[model samples]
Target: MTDAPTLHFGVFEVAAPQVGGTFSWAHPRSRSADFLDPQHWIHIARVLEDSGFDFLFFAGGYGYPLVDGDLPEIAATKGINFSAIDPDYLIPVLAQHTDTLGFVVTLSTGLEHPAQLARRLASLDHLTSGRVGWNIVTGASQNAVADVFGQDAIVPHDTRYAMAAEYVELAARLWEHGWDDDARVVDRESGVYARRDGVRPVVFEGEHYRSRGYFGAPPSPQRTPVLFQAGTSPAGRAFAARNSECVFVQATTPARTAAAVADIRALAAERGRDPRGMKLMAGLTVFVGETEEEARRYEAEFDAMQTDEIVASLYAGNTGIDLLALDPDKTLHQVLGQGSVGEMGTSNIDRFLGENAPTVREILDQLKGRGTRGFRLVGDGTQVADGIERLAAETDLDGFLIEPVFEPADLEDFGRLVMPILRERGRLREGAPGNTLRARLTEQPGNDRLGDAHPVLAAD
Candidate 1:
């Protein structure tokens, strides 16, 4: 009944202050809001569900943003951190409140064994009554490696993806092929409810990890939980195209977004997948009001609340460049060569800002365009919906990974005002929630495991 194409919208959990633009932590002075308070998140999630969101993603990492080798400036401003509230456990709390709101939790293949991660995610799926997703990440920063594994040697870029490939495959085996439909039944009469022959043991021994035998639990609603991928370097894109059901893309322009979507879809086609099956969700932030001028006024107010020094500090940590040490005029080309290359993709410093270093005043405004790797829409409800629709239509993106520009209120507006328009247009999911994250986002069959198009689906 709507004109918009089938797309599912999900909220991208912002770690601190402003949802879209980098804001302060819960308390800038004390930073003390407990990350596990389900009440706080429930307020956000309920708005999303009422406003028509398909899911809400809780994203985090083990370490802080160590981009350019500095944290003091970022820390003082209470900008984003390398550490986040452990969020997997929050799923049950969130599920206890809402029925259709799916949860996506980030865990990397580089850190743990497939058995442990698979069982954990499966348990979440079980506890959440089947509304859960697993975001597959390769370690983005070495800090996490040092912190989690107590090893300082970050794996090489290509090697990280290589290990991820193996990790994802092993997970598929444990979740998909390990059990049959009738593996568990707590019946008292026959005394034997489980069919032993039906539950198969998966034996995997690769260069990185090896697994022997069946998984610990019976299948959850979504066995492999929808696999979400977020990297887009050449190797990164390849990994996503092969294993990912949902792709989170960050970019600055609608044109760039269109190209990225086409690029990934082409890669999927080369792998013999129906390119349409891959859902490309781009980053976005919004400010809304009864009128356009009012929305503009709101953005200016939020921008005033932002501390540029703190923003730069986060930029420094994320890039590993020690921004304070260099004069703003110093070129990025020079700084990167001088051992400032301790981090991963600094798209803020690389693609958008493009110079090694620019003066604060001249560069700070420029930094806004690339923060989340997508266009940040600022306007009233109608205008905001107009822009989102434009981005989706022009770029051919499936939907958005919405970030809040002003914490709870920013999210509140999107759900209240913009979402209905999108839902009316068919730009957001118009259907009832599915049993699993995969089924909710995709129209394809609910496999409860990796589909045949995924590389992991063929490894056995």
Candidate 2:
């Protein structure tokens, strides 16, 4: 592997809006309402692929985001596209349109059967020619349990991760050991279609799940899809160390991101794996324009599209904390105490509170003005590139998971304006390289299968 401080890039998008308001779709110059159209995503895939992005990561959840404790306002106003459509259906279409771009689709381990998830992901890997990644998430919203799964209540956070641990282990066995390397012998000469010994049945009985059958499909190019985990709690970190190939993290500053990366790498080492094996990708939102003033203008426009109530509601949905009910004068520490809303959301709020100790009202103002929960980089092409370079250098991050503001236009602008600067600085890959998602992200061409350090292989 190369030791060069080269940077990688990916986009963080939801299948639909997760909030109750709109920005890009409301812009006078934007035609973003066609976001639901397959053509829109196809165009986006091509733009990102041509720009040499490593992947397009999709975020998802089950139920509508609540406003305070009610969902009426969000639903009536069409606030966010709370779980609009499945990325599983979208990835294949995107695959057909783009040759080099990787597709990372989120799947919650808390809701699906392991065997079914394994089969679906394996088929996607085949369809994408090994360019598929699975973002493993343990469901956070209690509404998902009731609305999506017909369950009564949400599973406890730590318990959900515990179940996910077993779920992934079972799925890994199906992916890794279900079929031999040469299981698919299409020889038509002898009357023998295949060897019975090549395919093996996987019988697993875990605390939360049980399965007994051979994997239905043969191994694809990557054998197992690239594993991505997005959680920052202690249990979540432990899970990532054992199973994740790429980790999605959110931090307000490069220093905080560096600390998170350091901790994850150390955890990986403790688990008998190479510290660098797990790639840390910080979540960021970018607003790019031809000039700094123009970019700031765009940022202001987007920021204005959001209101304090909508911002607080989104925050409440993420962390299970009702900011609307909070005392405006109380510090976050005094209000939140030890209870966590969700792994990723709670971590971010805690980081912000620890750093700034902003009161509830101040926090709401920050959220309203920022337009995103993570770091927001707003500038012209050169300025954005400089920020990216500095972030990579200071944090030793593998890359960023960019959350775009204006569906196609924002990304298109980045490609046309910002990418050339990044290329000139030798920060981005020069060409497509035509490889699997795992190989592309890790920069280790031809090594498509899971490494020996993974817990799945240890189970062998």
Candidate number achieving the greatest lDDT relative to the actual structure: 2
What lDDT does each candidate get? Answer: 0.71, 0.77
Q: Which stretches of candidate 2 lie over 4 Å from their true place?
A: 1-4, 17-23, 67-69, 75-78, 81-83, 333-345, 352-356, 369-372, 430-434
Off by more than 4 A, model 1:
14-21, 24-36, 67-70, 76-79, 144-148, 337-343, 346-363, 368-370, 431-434, 444-448
Which structure among the candidates has the greatest TM-score? Answer: 2
How far residue 3's Cα lies from its native spot in candidate 2, in Å, is 8.1
Error of 1 at 294 (Å): 2.3
Deviation in angstroms for 40 in model 1?
0.7
lDDT tens digits by residue: candidate 2, 1-460: 3345668788987767431233355676454566578887898899999888889988776755554456636434644444477768999899988888999988989777998999999999999999999999987455534556667556777888889999999998899888888878878887665578998999998899999998978898997899999877677788898889999766567787788888889998888888887788877778899999999998888877777766665665666666777788886766554444543355546655665587888888777744344667889999998888777788878888877777788889999888888877777764354689988877778879985558766863
